[model samples]
Target: MNKKSNAVLRLIGILLLTIAFCVLGYLNAKNIKLGLDLNGGVSITYQTVEENPTAEQMSDTVYKLQMKAQSYSTEAQVYQEGKNRINIDIPGATDANEILAELGEPGTLQFADEDGNVLLTGDDVKTATAGMTNQNNNREYVIELHFTEAGATKFAEATKNNVGKRIFIIYNNEVISSPNVKEAITGGQASISPIESYEQAQKIASTIRIGALPVSLTELRSNVIGATLGAEAISTSLQAAAIGIALVMLFMLCVYRIPGLAASLALFMYVGLEMVLMQAFEVTLTLPGIAGIILSIGMAVDANVIIFTRIKEEIGAGNSVEKAIKSGFEKALSAILDGNITTLIAAAVLYIRGSGTVKGFATTLAIGIIISLITALFVTRGLLTAFFALGATNPKLYGIKKETKVINFIGFRRIAYSISSLVIIVGFIFLAMNKKNTGDIFNYDLDFKGGSSTTITFDKDLSMMEIDSEVIPLFTAATGGNASTQAAKVAGTNEVIIKTRTMTTEERTKLYDSLQEKFSISEDKIVTENISGAVSTEMKKDAVWALLIAIFCMLIYIWIRFTDIKFASASVMALSHDVLITVTFYAVLRWAVGSNFIACILTIVGYSINATIVIFDRIRENLHNGSKKKGLEYVVNEAISSTVTRSINTSLTTFISVFVLYIFGVSSIRDFTLPLMVGIVAGAWSSVCIAGPLWFDFVILSKRKKEQLSKK
Candidate 1:
């Protein structure tokens, strides 16, 4: 490798550029964001029921409703809320009343018999579709009927003999219009004429054209969100994130000194890059979203480890200062990309299927992966590469050592194996023993329990006593009549969330009717949201399957990319460790400090696994390419040392970002950010000390012994 002028100079230029970005980020740390989930803000999704309509139809209705509603007032910002819910964030509109009235303009179609007696109601029609045609030489937007053949046949018989008689179309218990039927049409088809505008004609055609819902939906969960907790959460996370970042930086300086400073500088760039990626990709920064960013800090350190270790190795390999810098990065590049790439694949899979907070995790994680790779591979490596190019050749000055690559990890297998086994076993036992106390398993959250919550934010604060005595009790009598509050909006104010462990469709309706009376809203304003057991079960299954599949996909990727089973197996095992340890931590935390534990576990799983994979990717290279005389032991040592700094740097930077979130972020974020911070530390330790070394001690050494014994 050339150690001279041009090649070395290029390396210096890149390093300086990366350094500049870090300077910029450090200056802007105060502006970084923390998601609401981490900070305890209520995220409510209000979906208008299908009323026997499709998702597309419901969305269309919501779009129009928002415009119509806004016409009444301009305070509504509409978004596509969960499933079919419409999210309307109205600033200062505590009533949330006028918004509902605009959305729920009743389109009930009352079907009357020959003597004008009602035969059925809009409740009987499931759905309707509309189109255009020329009727009796007049062009009209024709509404077509798709009814339950029963609804269709009765209408056909009624219209067959009354071809020229006026057939009244009463909606909302009022006569909309009456048109004489020119012909009797069968096969569940019908048309109405002289409708309002083309838009209104389409609306009426679609509304009156459809069939009825199987059962009326009532709001089972509705309550004003408490702003009190949100404020507290905001205060808590920001402080934790700040403390965490400072601690990691302090540790790096203590351990690596000059190199540590360089890595920290690199870390700053990583954060800046990560934010740009998140915005460029349009990732929503939710509670789990902050977890991803903070966790990414760890993964980013992993790349730094790879490069730092390689730099150390090249120096040991007897290269000139410049040559060593170039070679170290060249050797470590493949490993850095391989590791981050694998975790990246998992993040991608998650984003595609995960909804709500899950999507947030995947999105931020994926962004972290991309930027982590960029900084570690290009920015950090290029900067280091440039540093050597600038003619700075004091091995002592840069902290290059005479004996850095001689550490042995293969001899510590017994201890590692024993400790790992104990941790895994303890985790399983703890999970099993306390399964009943855990959420969903024991006292599931409303997500699985199938309920609704409405957070009413008054223009001013209200008394909890009044709400409990009036609002909650009214809803309790309405929601399954066994109204229970799993967790009221601990965030005080006029806000609250009402919940029930279970409620059927009828029970939900009755609950809504009761709340309408108590909240002083029209019956229509008390919108209903029903949660079905089947849908809940499916969502549960999907969540589990998605995680498992992500793990499996990652396993196969490591095996195929590295062309070895041992490497992949070790990686999978280490990942399993990260996940289990995370869960154990969560259980202990939740058991002790009542935080949202599951988010922490999931965030840890993703963070740790990414670290392990990156380290393993680097180790595989030393196995395949390093000189053989030094044997597997040397190769393993070389691999670990070569990637060690990258790991440390990645982990440190990731922790720094996480620390920032934990401190400066919010309470909602702390539940996730704090655990994630712990998990990052654990994940780093496991990947370097556990996963990387274990592979050589067991598989590499075992193969050598079998060969020796077979020689006989």
Candidate 2:
């Protein structure tokens, strides 16, 4: 056996390089900003009026009040939070009374007299929009009144003798609606309902109810983001990142020595590249993204571990130093590529399928996977080549200890066969159960379903129990469901986010009407986000393309690196198998419950790539050692047998991390992480049991063709 490989020296180098990056990441942490999800701010909701007033009117009123509020205090930033709320973010100002002075500016109301004399008022109410409910159908509309009670009485008196006289209804000094008096009225109950259609009535009614903002707001929940807090989160994340990298580096160095030093250098390269790529992609560096960085750090090391293990086996088999270096790297190459590719697929799927915070982590993980691949393949190899060129021959650096390759993995192919069948069957069973119960076979998220979300700010503090009682039935019934209808039960969820299952546009319109009747919301507040079918299809296509492209690139990489088509084929085939199985899991779950099944499938694709790469690494090493061997199956089996434990262990470790994320992570992100956990196991299994055994068929066929060509 060749004993010339310097495993010890390589480990030491990896360790040293790891430390360098730890320090850099720590120092630079201050520059990173926390995304919106981590540091929450005020989400104020105005009481929706039955009629939606004109935007110009709302803007004019809001602008005038905002200016008045600013004059009283210059610390407010007012923004249209959504359809029904004006968000005033006041830094360091929480008192409602402080800004009350700005309220009631341009006071438009009048305290009038019955004789029509000049009274205590800034202006007579020329026009006022009122929201009223229909007694029979319970439908509501916006009523524009041209006169106050006194004016109405006087108008009614005048109109009694002259029935053709028109009374103009004006609001905000504009004649919006005019309805002639039908008869003289003695009381103050005269109503003017201005509506061309039921829909228009609802819109106008909503606008009327939002009413005019009295004095602008005194900041409540203002100063949501302080410079100090922003700086602190940045500093904290950086410090944590630095400490983690340093600790990892130190651990690698002490444990693996010289090769650790090499791995450390590779790891640093990965970190640097990841930072640049993340910045380029414009992915917000949130807490979860930070966690992804940490996970990638571990993954980068796993690549080095695969290489080192192969180098040790070569040395045990009596390979020379130069031979071991080439063979080990060659052998380890497939596993490293396959592992990173799987992760990339998962990340890509996540990036395409996920929105908001899930995208943040997915983007980061994707970047990390690509960068880690570069470091593992290029950076680590570059560093090792340099060491070898320097004539530093030490076995300890690479950590290659002589050991025999025992136990024919091919002999155990039946067990692998058994596991694969069981997995497929179990997957199908889940799919069947999911189908038997649910009709659609997949559930959709709010984004795809055109959901209506309203955050209502009230003068009172109402708990969710009260909200559920008041809010749910109104919206549900409005959406065309019976008020007493049943909605699919969302797991582990309370009334915080009350959502209905997917509803059609007509249903949505009906729901809008119902909710207006129920909540007295203005038309604009009834925001129904319509999702386009084209957009959904595009998203699905993009997700699938991303995975295909990633695998294609990895296949090219394997073919080029190992100079073996069979190796590339095996690696990609395994990755595809993993992806299929992962997708099957999603299908099963979708059929089992109900639509966002795409998110799970996306996560699974990325998660499965890792397993494919690990197995490929083993195949490459065995092929390199037996590059001239007749029995390719023996080499393939040997490679699988050696790396099984490491692959399994790494899979387990990542699974643990994903499990933590799945269990403790925010509810909004659970759907994203849960699939990844299952994908990890499936991915690992395919890499070892699936990708490994299948390569022989390709190899035997290739050889048979080659022999036929030689005879020709």
Candidate 3:
């Protein structure tokens, strides 16, 4: 093909890809799963009646509940809550009572004769599934049952003797079905056929499956969150995201000109591609997941900014636009790769080890990272090349990168170190004070600590703001400000569920009277129950282990890639610094530490490591590229100064995105985004001020030791 033909074909290909992505994204958009926090759903907690349930029993129960909850939504989450409780979260569900009724009682499954002769129990059952079988030239739904070895033998004997007699499948003392034995079956598997529709078959299958739980459970609490609330949350989040992204794109265009415009186009494609991928992979998007997507968008911008800045630098050195583009990408590759890979490491660990909402956050984050890499490395590069082919490749249009004067970062290392130390120390002091004052190091929300959940059906639907400003104050006043409350509106209803610290009878009565007086709600419309923490102690232990593994993995990766233990150590130190500083913010501000806390910390780690890697990449590059002859101080200082603009631009874009989230989001989202914003700023500071200096000191000390060894 001729050059003009190739350019036309490339442009045509880009347009076709864009259109295809949009079509796929739009078509599969409905398949995108929303989590409980996004699409208000039923959150039911069940407590085992047996005291001190074994871990095996808890695991079995959770597994059974997970299977049962999948009937409501495939994205339903069932996990252990605290020690002896199981919590099921079904998103986009409104009817709590209906769900509970369908979930049924955690009772035994038994096979009995019409004469009340007991045959076999659920313990004999290995698995039960619903499927269609051909019968009399028509498809009929059937429940296929597979029994255990012992159960199979017993069932075979019973069927042999009870041929032509009715055998009932009983669950929770209720007869589900009574099928006549046709013939003596020697096989362990049996089919209960000629049932109703597929839905009925599914219901029967679910009932049989529920019998897999080892222990009986009673409802501890059931919360119905309104779908309208979820819709509102999603709408506002999108609005915020659109506004934030527009601002970022505008900033990019104004600063980097043509490259910025190309980046903006790539970013748009990035979002569309991510949505399509999420739908294709059946990834569940929670509120925190949305936060992850927005955060990753910032990272995408960061990558492009790094490359564009390098390109500008090459242009400033009198290189042709094509040469600058090639050189810029080459120079920026290490920083982008190291930064994104470190974040991906954390995300992978989180997905492997984290549970429920944390996993949701990780899924979005991981997907975002992978998609961002595609857009940054390929899509952005292609667009820039296409723009160049279209004759818009003036060096001035790409902006000239002025030479950056080296800043003496190593000399000011002490000030940065002291500032970080002072902040962390003050955070410790705050933790101590908080411990003494509240009997906890940090403020724990309902997810961490068990609480009293009050479900109220109001006369009309109330917004979250009204619930916070109007209803929460009633509880606070009644409890003398000792109660920390969180509320969610039930979808498709005027019901709101409020959770707070365990309430006394007097406090409950007081709350009742206040609700009756203020909202004119009847006692019948209100339900109160004590609920266990959604994030159990065991899960918290798992989170700690996951974080440790993530850090260790990152350390190994950096050491291998950069070929320097000091660089890895300094990066880890900066990561630790960022996390600790964020914790301090949570401690001092007393932000409600809920399930999102783990996600917040993980995000900071990812953000911090990425920032650290950028500076480290520069330092490594400088060290090898003739700057090492000037000594470690000059190399470190020059690296920090050269990459400072990229660091600031990336941080600013990320901060703005999260800041917009805080401004437009609900209280829960605000809590998540606020800490995230703080972490972004903290990560940037640590990367520019902390990580580089720490590495410099390591090198300086190593050099001094080598000199001493030479003298010896």
Candidate 4:
């Protein structure tokens, strides 16, 4: 084949693969699982009747509930609350009442005498199975129960004492069955016969098998909650993503020209592949998950920017287009690998350690990172080569790097440190002030602090959009806190549930009057009850531990990759700076600290570390290649100067993506994107100003310590 023909074929092949991925993404979009916040679900809480339940008992119950709920959908989440409550959120479930009816009451199952003296609790049942039995030529469903050795002995003795008398099988203090003791059999098994149908028998058997909760439970509150955000939220987020991607593509094209186009194409494929993989893996998507996907797009762009920057430099150094392309990717490899691997480590740890929502974020993040890496490394390279082979090989087309003097960023290090210290100290001051004024260090939303759930039956059907826009503000205004609304699952009734921070009586009354006056509904129609926070203390602990472990793992990886502990130390210190700064924003601005708080903090940790690694990689490279006569300060300054353009471009593109999200997304999504935007800027600043300087300081301190020791 001629050169033109080969290039045509390659381009066609890339187009075809892109098309295939886009088609698959579109087809599978509906199949992607959405979490409880995105899809309406049954949110039910069960409190242990016992005053104090053992942790073991609660854990066992939570595990059993998780298994049971997963039977409905693999995305179901069952978690423990405060001390003795278990919260089960089964996403995509419409009817709360149906779920309640079939969920089977989790309580003690007692086999007792007619006098009500208990013979055996559910703990004694080893297993339960449902089967058919024939009696007098009629087939009927039966429940077969297998007992533990102790249970068998107890049952045999009970039957012996109550021969020919009625013995009761009870569940939740209600007699479910009463049968005459036919004989004192010593067998370790028994059968409950003459069930109406197989379904009933199975239900009974399942209840018996799973009913062995160490502590009895009572339904505290059961709600069929609608999606936290309405359909508009999804639509707006998609719009933001589309607009952001277009802007990024335009920016790339105007700047990098041909290579920019190739990167854009790769980005499109990245998005499509992300959608397809998420569906294929059955990863649940939530609002925070969406944020993660968008953020990863920015990081994907960062990889391409790094490579293209290197390519431009190579070309400026008088290399051919072909050589530049190859050398560009080669030189960019270490930074790309180090950055993505470190972030991937964080995502992996978060997935393993986090609960439902955090796990969703981690899953999407990991998928995006892997796909972006492939697209940047392989797909973008292939396209650039194809375009080059097709005859667009002019050095000007891909832009020539202009030589510039290195800026002494190290000279300004003291100013940067002072600014950072001042900001962080102010943050601490505000935290203290908040604690003193509000009895909390941050604005804890309903997810963090237990709140009130108000279920109201309206006179007319109000769509979820209406509840979000029209109803939520009323509650928020009245309660002076963030409020989330959910539509009730009942078919005909126009019921909506509003959740907010625990409201005082006056606030409740004010809300009641406002709701009644606005909708002209009767006072009796609305009902409110206090509910515990969805984010538990244990979850908070898990998030903290996960982040710590992830940071440690990333530190080790950076140290090993760069062959210096100083790089790892500098990276970790920069990460802390970013987090602390972001938290300061959260404190000063008083953003609602909810589930998104964890997502935000973890995201900053990942973003900052990746950014820091890029600069560190550059410094490492410069150290080996640059003149040994140059001082450490000159080497660090030159490395930062060379990579400064790449850093700014990447951060700008990322900021553009998230900025659009903030502008176009719903209020809740905006709340999420807000802190994220702050984090992105902080990450950029620290990578440029903080990370390199910190490394320099560490090296200086180490050398001085060694000199002192030698003199001694």
Candidate 5:
């Protein structure tokens, strides 16, 4: 085919693929499940009554709970929280009482003789499931049971001796069914028939499954999440995201002009493809996950920004547009790979080791990175090529690369190090003071600390702002300002659920009376619950371990790729610097450290490492190209100077997206986005200033030490 004909065909192919993804994404959008935090649901935490439960016991309990939860909904999640606590989250469930009633106790199941002598216990039962059987040409529900070898032998003996006698199936000390033994059955399989309905059979099956729990459990906390809260959050978040994305697209087009327009088109494809993948993979979308997606959108743009900048530089160097495009993508490949790989490493570790919403955040981030890579490297490149072929060859439209001088980054390395150290030390001091004042290292919210949640129905609907200003003050004053409050207004209703530190009886009464007097809420419309902390001590340990592992993994990857411990060490230090600074913001500001806090911290780690990698990639390239001809200081300075614009531009775009989220989002979302914005700035600073200089110092000192050793 002619060159023009080939270009037309490729463009048509790209258009078709884009249209297919859009259609698929739209069709599967409804299949994406919103997590409990986004949609009203029942969140229940159970503590093992058995003291010092073993890992196996905890695992068994969690598995049983997961099975029980699955009976409630396919999207239900059951996972261990702390050492001996299990958290069950059932999305789309609004009635806490109903869920509790249906779940019942994690009671033991036993087979007994007529006199109530126990023959076998639930431990003997291998599996139980609800099944349908044909009886007398009618469909009847039944519970199919399978037993272990020992249990089967015992059951056979019992049935043989008790033929024509009645045996009772008992649960929680209550006789559920008694059937006469007809024969000495030697088989391990049996069936409980004559069940009235499938629902009842399924309930019995679930109960039987619960019998596998090696230890008993006590309800630590139960929460009834209103669906309206999540629905409204989704609506507001979507609106904000739409607006932010539109602004980003406009900015890209106006700045890069034609090339920027091509990137904008590619970004749309990335979004559509990401949505379709989320639905196909059944990844849960939580509020934090949405934040992750927004962050990754900025990252997606960063890749394009790097490529475009390189293209501009090549064109300025007097290369043809086609040649510049090829060279630009080639030159940008190393930086893009290193940056995305580092971030991907963090996401992978988080997904493997993190739990609950942390996993969701990691999953979304990983998906976003992968999709962004595809779109940026292939989709955007193809589209840009097509546009150029169709007559977008103006160098001015693509942007001109201005000549720039290298800044002496090494000369000011000490000052940068001192400033970063001072900030970090101050952050630690704030944490120490916070620990002393509050008896906790940070201001942990209800999700991290067991608290009392009060749901109050007012005569009139109140906005979150009104509740914060009018009602929260009453609670704060009552608790001597020691209480932290989080309130969410139930959508389509005048009810709000307010969570605060555990309240005494007197405090509860005082708060109820105050609400009644202030808002004229009826006594009958108010309800209070003592909720267990979602992040148990063990869960916190897991989170810490996950982070450590992530950092270690990134270190190994950098060392292997760069073949230098200095680069790896510098990168990790930069990541730690970003995290500590962000943590300081939380501590000094006394921000409520909740579930989202974990997501925020991990995000900073990923983002900071990405920025660090970009600079380091440039340094490695310069080192390889310059060899020993260039001094360490010159190489480091040049590397930093070359990538400084990228660091600033990427950070600015990411900050803009998150800043918009904070501005337009609700209180909970604002809390998440605020810290994220700070982290983005910190990551950028460390990448441009700290990472390169630190590596330079390491290289310079090492060489000097080698020379001294040679003299010796």
Candidate 6:
């Protein structure tokens, strides 16, 4: 075949693959499970009656609760919170009261003879299932129970001695059922038949399952999340993402022309494949998870940007277009691998240690990073190659880099260090002042600090936007700080739940009066309760451990890859700088340090390290090519100078994606993206100004130490 014909065939194959994935993604989009925040659901926490529950007890309770919850929805998740708390999240559920009612109070279950002799406890039961039996054209609900070997043997002896006697099933010290034994029952399974209804039988089954828990549980708090916020969030997020993708595509096309077109196509494939993979993996998509996808979109663009920039440099060095393309990819490999691998490590750690939304975010992020790497490395390459073969190989289309002098980033290190230290110091000062004044540093939202949840049945229905603009402000004003609102998801209900910092009785009464005065709500319609933080102490500890482990792993990887501890040390220092600065923004602005805080901080850790590694990779390259003879200062400066464009462009593209999300997203999303924006800028700044200079300082100190040791 001719070159043109082969190119056409490759292009056709690319088009086919893109279409296939896009079609699959579109068809399976609904199959992607949305989180409670996005789908509206019930979030309930149960506290063990025991003050210090054993780990085995907690684990058993969590497992039983998970099985019970899964009966309601397969996507249900039950996880241990603190030592004595178990949290159940059932998405796609409305009416928290109904769910709580059906879930029942978890306590002991016992099967006793009519003489009140205990025969079996819940611990002997393996599982319970509610079913129906047809007899003589009549359907009767039944609760089937399967028992352990010991329970089966015990039941056989009991039934053999007490044939035709009634056996009472007691749950929580209440007689739930009494079934007569017709004969000796030897099998491990038994059924209670002729129940009134399936719901009743199912209730019994659920009770039995929960009763199997080793620890008794009391309801601590229950939240009925409305679908409105999620609907608005999803809609607006999609809009923002679409606009951001279009903007990115336009920017890429305007800058790199043909290669940009190739990248845009690869981006499409990336999204399509991401959706398919997420569905395949059954990864739950939360708001932060969406942020992960969009951020990865930016990162996907970053990989392309890195390669295209290198290709331009190669072409600018007067190489042929085809050779430049190959050389550019080869040269960009290490930075790309190091950056991506570090992020993957973070994601893996988070997935392993984190729970709930944190796990969700980690899963999506890990998948996105993998897919982005593949698309950028393979799909983009194939498209570029086919385009090249089809005769679109003008250097002008890709643009040539002009010769530029090396910037002395090292000379400005002192100023950079001073500025960073000033910002961080001011942040700490503010934190101290806030702690002294309010007894807390960084405004803790309901997700972190626990708060009062007030459910109000208003006279008229209100949309999420209206509630945000009108109702939540009143609550915030009453509470003297931030407040969150959720409309009830139940049909024909005009209820809205408002959450704020824990309030006094007087404050609650005042807020109730305000609501009555404004919306003419009845005093009886308002219900209030104090709820604990959703981000439990255990989760916080897990996040910290995940971050610590991720950083340690990344440091080791960078040390091995660069063959120097200084590069890894310098990179970690730069990461610390970005994190502290971003936290400074949070403290100064008093951004609500909520669940998204963990995601934001971890993201900065991953992002800052990626940028730092890029610079370090360049420095390693320069040193390998014997650029170190000029001096460590020159080597660092030249590396920073050479990669400055890539750093700025990558940061800007990522920033643009997140910026648009902030601009167009709902309040919750804005809360997430704002700090992310700060972190991105901080990451870029530290990578450029901090990492290289810090490495230079490290080398200088090492030499001084060696000289002193030798002299001594």
What is every candidate's alpha-carbon RMSD to the true fold?
12.5, 19.7, 8.2, 9.6, 8.9, 9.7
10 residues in a row with least lDDT, candidate 2: 483-492
lDDT of 2 by residue, 615-644 (tens): 656566566676438477777776677777
Q: Write the per-residue lDDT of candidate 6 for residues 196-294, one digit (tens) a residue.
A: 999889878878887888888899988766654747789899999998888888888988888899999999999899999999987767777788788
- In model 2, which runs have C-alpha deviations exceeding 4 angstroms? 1-36, 39-277, 285-291, 314-366, 373-400, 448-452, 460-535, 552-569, 587-630, 701-712
Q: Where is model 6 more than 4 Å wrong at Cα?
A: 43-87, 93-215, 218-225, 228-230, 459-466, 481-494
User: lDDT tens digits, residues 524-547, model 1?
Assistant: 434334432212233344456667
**Which of the two candidates, 1 or 5, achieves a greater lDDT against the reference?**
5
What lDDT does the true structure give each of the candidates? 0.56, 0.53, 0.84, 0.83, 0.81, 0.83
Note the clash tally of each candidate: 74, 92, 6, 0, 0, 0
lDDT of 1 at 83: 53
Better of 1 and 4 by TM-score: 4
Model 6 RMSD in Å is: 9.7
Predicted candidate 3 versus true structure: per-residue lDDT over 356-410, tens digit per residue: 5556667778888888888888888888887788787789999998888999999
Pick the winner on lDDT between candidates 2 and 6.
Answer: 6
| Candidate 5 error regions (>4 Å) | 43-87, 93-214, 218-225, 228-230, 455-497, 504-506, 518-527
lDDT score for candidate 4 against the true structure: 0.83
Model 1: weakest 10-residue lDDT segment is 214-223
Tell me the RMSD of model 2 versus the true structure: 19.7
| lDDT tens digits, residue span 1-712, model 4 | 8888888888999889998999999987988877676776788889888889987877667755654564455457666666787878888777778998888668778888977788888777766767898878999888787888998999889889998898887777777667778888688898877788887777677677667667778888787767767677788888999999999999999999999999999998999899989888878787777877887887789899999999999999999999999999999999999899889998999887665456666877789889989999989998999999988889999999987468989999999999999999999999999999999999888777767778789888888767766788888789675554333333345877776777889999999999999999999999887666666565677778888998899999888998889999999989999999999998999888888888888887877777788788888887888533599998889888888899899999999999999999877788899999999999899999999989999999999999999999
TM-score of 1: 0.60
| Model 5 per-residue lDDT tens digits across residues 438-511 | 79988888778768767788888776557767988988876778777766666567878777888888888888
Looking at model 3, which ten-residue stretch has the lowest summed lDDT? Answer: 223-232
lDDT over C-alpha atoms for residue 386 of model 5: 83
